[model samples]
Target: MMILSWRRRRGGHRTSKPAFVEDNPGMDLAIPTHFLCPISLDLMKDPVTLSTGITYDRESIEKWIEAGNEICPVTNQVLENFDQIPNHAIRRMIQDWCVENCARGMERIPTPRIPVAPRDVLEICSKIMTATQRGDHKKCMELVEKIKRWGRESERNKKCIIENGSGCVLSALFESFSSISIQEHEYLLGETLSLLIWMFPLGSEGQSKLGTAPSLRCMAWFLKERNISSCQNVILVLKELFSSDEKHVNAFAEIEGVEEDLVKIVKEQTCPKSTKASLMVIFHLISSSTSSEKTISIFLELGLVSLVLEILAGPERSMSEKALRILDSICNWEQGIKKASDNALTMPVLVKKILRVSNLATDFSVSAILKLCKSQEGGDHQQVEALQLGGFHKLLVLLQVGCGEKTKEKVTELLKLLNQQRGRLDCFDSSMDFKYLKRPSL
Candidate 1:
C-alpha cells in the first residue's frame, strides 16, 4: 500500500503526482532522502564508482569496514571479501535509488504491527531498581547491559526501532528518587529524567516494552519517602517525549508504569504543550495496560479533548493521521466517544468531531475516522446512535461510496456493531479499515 507523504513543491497550486514506476504511494521518485546507499543502507554516503567492473568510494565504504561491520546492503552477505565492490548488478541498484528519490520504493514503506507494551518511565527504572534494593546488582547490571546492547543495535537499523532499554534504565533511576527523602526527590527525578532525555534516540528502534517489570514497587517508595516533588521532573520528560519526534515516541512505547505519575504531574501543573505531544504518544500505546484507562480519563478531565480535537480537525496529514491513531486507541474501539459520559473525558464532542472527519475527510483521514469508529464497542447502540445523531450514517455512506470494499467492510462492521451491539472480543479489526484511499473530498 502507498503511504502518502507530503513533499514541498515549487510553482504548484497543490502537488501534482510525480511519475512513478510502480504502485508504491510513498515512492516519490523525486526525493533523495528516501533512497539508501546500495552499499551501507545508510544515506548513499560519499557516492562513487570504480572502473574495473566494480564500484565504491574511499571515505564512506572505508568507515563501515573499519567499524568491524561487513554486511553489504545489496547482497545481505558479509563483505569479508571486500576485494572489489560487488558487480554492476549491485551498482545499478545503487544508481537507480540515487537517480530516483527511491528506487522501486519498496524499501521504506512502513508495515504496522501490534504493540505488546506501554512505554512507562517509572516502570522501566523500577525493574532494575528492584534488583538494586535486593542487592542483586548483578541482575541489575545484566538488565542494564541488555538494554544498552538492545539500544545500540536497534538504532543501527535503517527503519525506526523502539529503544526499550533506555526506559528500563530510566524507570530504574526514578526508583532511586523514591529511595531518598523528599528533598532529594527533585534532584533524583531530575537526574533520572535527564538520563532518559540524554539517551534520546537510543540506537533508533524508537520504542520498546516495559510491561510488569519491578517498576511499580517505586510508588510505595515514593509514598514512603514522600517524594512527590520529583514527580515534576518525570512529567517534564513525559512532556519532552511527546513534543519530540517519532524517535521519541518509539522510545516511550517501551515504558510500563508511568500513568499515575502523569496524573500526579498533570494535577500539579498546567498543560504543557509538551504534555499534549506526550499524551499523543501515551494514548497510542496505552492499550489495555493497567493504567491505560486512568491516564486516558485524566487527559480527558484536563479538557485535552479540545486540544486533541484541534489536531483531529486540522489538515496537516501527518498530525491528523496521528491524532486519529491516538483517538482510535483511546476510544478502545471508539470507547472514547462514550468516555465523556462515564469517564471525565470529552466523549460526546469528540465523537462529533470524529463523525465530521469521517464523512467529509479524504484519504488516510478517512481511515483514521473509521478506525476510531471501529474501536467503539459496535455492540453499543448508544455509541452508534450518538455518532449517527452526529450524522455518522451519512459519513459511512460517504466512505462506502468514496472508498473501497476494505473501507466498506470496516464501515459495515461499525454499522453491524451498532446494529447488533457487539464487538470482536479479541483485537480490533483493521483489515476492514483502510489507511490510504483516494478522495474527491466529500
Candidate 2:
C-alpha cells in the first residue's frame, strides 16, 4: 500500500520510482499507483475528487481553480462543481503506507485543515452587519476583528470573503461610522478601512458607497490622527478611490484642508512609506488638468517646491522620480512655471536630474525646465539662469548622448531659447562651440 512518486522524463510522460529501504539493503517497496495525484505526479497528501470523477491532490486542484480554470485538468471536461470532496479512503491508505515504510525516509502526512466555506463567511458577515445595525458597537468591533483574523489567515480565505460580498459589507461598515463621531469608533474605522484596502478592486458600487461626502470627510480626519497605520490606510484607500474615478478626485480636491493635509503628510509624517503615498496622491491630484491651477497654487503656497527640491537632492531614485513628475505636472501652468523659477534650487535641481536618475526622470526634468524657459514673464532671466546653472552643458550633453525623441525635441527648443540669449549670459563662451545646439534630425 506504499505510495510511489512519479518523475517526468525528457520525453512527455511520467515514470514511477519506488522507495528503497536502506535498512533492508536494497529492498524496493512498491507503492500503489492510484494513490498518486496526476497533477503533481506525487503521493497525494490530501486526495480530493472533482466533478469529473477524477481525484487529485487538494493543493493542486485548489491552485488550478484559483488560476481561473473551470475544466478538469485530466478529463478536459467542463466542471459542473468545483467542490473538492476529500477522499478519506485514499488518505487513510496513504497514511498506512507511510507507516509501513517508516524504516525508510517516508514521513506521515498530517491531516489537512478544513477549508472555509462560502456559507460560513456569509454567516459571519451577517452577524457583523446585524450587530452594526443594532448599534452594538462592541459586538461589531469584535466581529470585525474576527473577520480581519480570517482574512489574514490565507489568500484563499481572503478571496472567499471578497467573493462573498465582504467588500460591500466592509464598505457599509465604513459608512456606518459616518453618523457616529469618528472619535468614538476611530479604531474600528481604521480597522475596517485597512481591511478594505486589502480587498482591492472594490467594485464601482462599493467605491461609490465609500466615496460619499461623509465618508470622504471621515477619511480626511483619519489623516490628522496620531496613529501612523490609520493615516496610511486612509491615504491608500483614497489613492484607490481617486485613481478609479475622476469624480472622486474632484470630490477629494473639494475636501477642506485636503491639500494642506496632504502636504503636511509629505513634510511631517515620520513614516517614509506614508510620505511616498502622500506624494502619489499629490501626483494624481495635480496630474488632472481640471484641478491643475488650484492644486498647483496650494502646493506652491505650502512650499512644496522647496520640499521637492530637497527630495531631489536626496539619494532615493523613486522619490526623486515622483517629485519630478509632480513638478512636471505643476509646471504645465504659467503660475507653476513662475513659482518653480522663483525657487533658487528649482533650476539647479532640474539640471542636475537631466541624465541622472532614469529616462522618466530625465523627461520630466527636461519638461519642467522647458516649461519654465518658454514662459513670457521673466523667460529671458530664467534662460540666463539655466546657462549659469550649467543647464546649457546638460542640454548639449543630452543632445549629443541622445535621449527620448520627445525629450530631444524639448532640449532642442530650450537650447534655441538659450542660444538667442547667449549674448546676455557669460556661461556660453561662443556660439560656434554651440554649433551642435541645432535641432537634431528627426
Candidate 3:
C-alpha cells in the first residue's frame, strides 16, 4: 500500500505530492507508471535502487530500512544491505517530464543530497567527543546543533544517530557539563537537554548512566532554570531514569532543592505530563522506608502537604491518584501529619476520593486519612471533620463493598474513631445521606 511522505523544504512547503496536489488542485496531469514511486505512488523525485533490484523513492526506502525492515517491499526477498544507489537516469526522466508538464502545474523535484548514514552520524559523535575533551564549547555547540538538525530532518536520521552511539556520547557530554556551574554553559547545556529530550527512551543503559548522583544534581539545577522547556526536559529525563530503576531515588532525593523544584512543578500545574512525572518522582523519593522521614521532612518544608491536598481536589484522576499516594507516604511522618491536618482540603479530598477513583486510589485515600486521624494531636477535630465530610458513611460503604484487608482494617479503625467521636461531637449533620452506609459489626 502507498503512503505519503512528508518533508520540510527551504520555504516551508511540504515535499508530499498530496500536499502539492492540495495546493494546486487544477493540475490533473496523469503521471507515467514508471515515473511514480512504488512506495508512495507519487512521481519519484529522488529514485534510488535497492539491493533487491527494486526502485523506490530514496526517502521511502530509507524510512523502510531505518524502521528495521530488511526485506524488499516489492520483491518480498531479504535485503543483503541497506545501501541505496541513486537512479540518476529515472530522476532525470521525472524532472524532464515535470518540466514538459510545467504549464499543467507540475513542479520539478530538487536534487537530493546523500541521506545521513551511520558513518556520518558516528563522525559527528566523534567530533562532539573531541570538542568535549578539548573543552571547545563553541565547537560542541555547533556539532550539537548539527546533530539536532539531522534529527529533525528524518526518522531515518534519528535512527542512525541513536544506533551510532549518539545517546552515550550525549549522556557523557551532559554529565561532564553538569560538574560546572550551569551559568558557565547555560545555552549549550540547555540545547543539549532539549536534544536529549527529543531522543527519548535512551534505553536502559543510557538511563542507568544518567541516573547517577551528579546527573541528578544537574537535573535539579535545570529544574531551577527559568527556561520552561529545560525544566520540562529535566522532569521527563528524571522520570525515565527513575522509572527504569528505583535504586537511584535515594541519591536523587538527597540533592539540594530537588524536592522543592518538584513541588513547585506540581503546585504551579505547568503541564499535565510534567506534573504527573513530578508526582511520580516525588512518590519514588519518599516511598522508601529509609528515606521517608528525611524526604517527607524536605517535602513538608516545601508546603507539599497543601499542594498534595489541592491536587487531590482536582479533576484529573491520574494526578489525583498520584497525589493521594504521595499523601499516604507523607503522613508517615509526624510533621507531614501536622501539615496535612492543617490543610483545609485534606479531609474533604480524602473522603471524596474513597471509592471515587480506583482501588489503588481508594487504598491511598483511606490510608492517608487513617494516618492523619491516628497521628494528629487534635484527633477529636479531625474525627469530627471526617464525620462532617461524610467520611463515616464512606467508610461504612467501603466495608460493605469490601476492600483489601489492610484497607478494611484502616476503615474499621477510622470508623471506630469517627463513631466513638460522633456521640461527643454535636457538629455532625444528621441530615447527611447514609443510604449506602452499612455498619459493620465492629
Top TM-score: which candidate number?
Answer: 2
* Clash totals in order: 36, 1, 0
lDDT per prediction? Answer: 0.43, 0.80, 0.78
User: Which has the higher TM-score value, candidate number 1 or candidate number 3?
Assistant: 3
Task: Write model 2 residue lDDT over 275-358, tens digit each, in one string.
Answer: 887888888888775585776788789988888888888878888888999899878878878888888888889987887887
Residue pairs with colliding backbones in model 2 are: 2-31
Task: List model 3 lDDT by residue over 37-156, tens digit each.
Answer: 678766677899988878998877877887989899999999898779989999898888777865544567787766688889889889998988887889999999998888887776
TM-score of 1: 0.38
Candidate 1, residues 390-438: lDDT per residue as tens digits?
4344345456455556656656655654544324223323244433433
Worst 10 residues of 2 by lDDT: 6-15
Predict model 1's lDDT versus the native.
Answer: 0.43
Candidate 2, residue 87: the lDDT equals 89
